[model samples]
Target: MAAAWHRLWPVLALGTALLLAGCDEIGLKSSLSPQPRPASLRVVPPTPVAPSAQSLDLARYYHKVQNDLLTRGLLRTDGGGPDTPYSADDLARNFEKIVFYNEYSSGDGLSPAQRLQSGQLSRWSGPVRIGTEFGASVPPDQRSRDQAQIDHYAGRLARITGHAIAPVRNGANFHVLVVGEDDRDFLRRRLQQVIPGIGPAELDLFSNLPRSYYCLVIAVSGAHNPNDYTRAVALIRTEHPDLVRLSCVHEELAQGLGLSNDSPYARPSIFNDDDEFALLTSHDELLLKMLYDPRLKQGMTADQARPLTTAIARELMGQQPQDPI
Candidate 1:
């Protein structure tokens, strides 16, 4: 029994040594292996830049001017005001405004600032023909309405002035274009082809025109006579609000016929920039009559035309005129 016990003791000692060796190897590998940490969830913000002082001041000035125009009844949000009727006395008062304001030419590299301030009347010396061209994108209904309005206004103008104003499909010196704002690029290209010596400034004006300018009329004076308009271009926005489109149609077309500039003093008329009186009023009709009167010839200066204008206004009002000084 003593011999068997000594043999078993040797085996037990060897097994204990093997188990301890395996434990040490496992402990070394666990200590040496890498452990990954959870990634950090953080965010960083951008630094803000300050606006230029000039830009801030300009923004203020721009808003201030618009507000002033609003206060003076010169600019209206309701697309001008209702055409409140005015008496004959008001027509006399507005007559001078019409004659002087429409007497200046603004084409062929001539700026509005460069126009003659003399009381000369500017008008078409020759017969007037209006031709309308519509953008391909303009809706058919809109095109039809625009044409009807053009024809209607042309007749009205002719009757008022007793002038040979007619609507022609071809060879018209007065071109009326109806286009959407999105089609301005196409209009620019077409204009370059149609108008002789179309300048970059004109194209730029059309391309960069403010959205507020729903319509505009550009007239070119005759080369021989600065006061005689030889060509006129009228543009009307096709995709505007109904009243705005119609108002533009009335204003731009009439303006093309020589009552060009806007007069804040001219009440009950579409010739004022105030957007008051969307349609051509009776007062405007009388002014047109006065403009095309035989006595008031084209190219008469503002100073030369006032007396005659006053005379015409008095006659229209059925009032006796004072003798000219």
Candidate 2:
């Protein structure tokens, strides 16, 4: 019995050692091995993804609210223009782009979107008068050419908005100042003339403007109950290429008339920073028409105008005889 016990103890000890070795090989190899350390201390951020469906729904809801505030005029929707009409979707999308971007109320330090939703977008209750101010550096021939371009665009604007757009020598509400790229002094002087008493801080703001800023429009409205535009100014950089100059002219001039925001989503329209189109497309024409329509009045909040805007958009779409503009 003693001999058998000793023999069994050795066999049991051997089996126990074998089991322990198998467990170590199966589970402890990864723990014993050294892991590859990260190469550098830099940590990259994750890329932005598209807006989720819920996020898009929220955006659409906000857009609908803003559009409701845009509807206030009495003009009939069937009054079609020579240019083809756009779809309701296009009209609403462009309307959102126009109203939510491009602000001329920087003097008051209000965002374009804030001013728009609050019914602060400057409106021309009176005649829409335009004028051109040429810098001393501009040659006579070049001045003439610029004036011709301005006149042609002003006419197009008048035709599209069905408003009285006339070039005024004096008391012009909208002044287009054409300046050379290096004409910083001229730009400052004209800007001062338009917005007098702007402090050094404001001047500094303009002086340190981004290099990409080639042109801008500034429109002011009085403290009247309806918020009618008192004056407006457009600054164009003539040193840019002709196409760029033309594009600036188109965008700045149109933006001065209340659609003061640039939209990333706005395609086939000059009212975008993308430089997709050099001239205003048929889509932009429809927007201008909607803006000047008698139904939309100044001082209307987005909440107040969106319903009417929707109806007007629908009517305009219903009246379309050709393809989308």
The root-mean-square deviation over C-alpha atoms between each candidate and the true structure, in angstroms, is 35.7, 29.3
* Candidate 1 displacement at residue 164 in angstroms: 0.7
Query: Once model 2 is optimally superposed onto the true structure by TM-score, how far is the C-alpha of residue 235 displaced, in angstroms?
Result: 0.7
Error of 1 at 21 (Å): 99
Query: Could you tally the backbone clashes for each prediction?
Result: 8, 19
Model 1 Cα RMSD, 1 decimal: 35.7
Q: What digit string (tens of lDDT, one per residue) describes model 1 on residues 63-143?
A: 554445445654333322345656555665566555453222223222223432333456777889887878655666667
Best by lDDT: 1
Candidate 1 clashing pairs, residues 3+ apart or interchain: 80-275, 118-302, 119-301, 119-302, 119-303, 120-300, 120-301, 120-302
Off by over 4 Å in 2: 1-86, 100-121, 319-325
TM-score against truth, every candidate? 0.68, 0.64
Q: Could you give candidate 2's per-residue lDDT for residues 250-294 as a string of tens digits?
A: 777776676655555655565544333456776678778877888
Superposed Cα deviation of residue 65, candidate 2 (Å) = 38
Which one is best on TM-score? 1
Query: Over the full model, what C-alpha lDDT does candidate 1 score relative to the true structure?
Result: 0.55
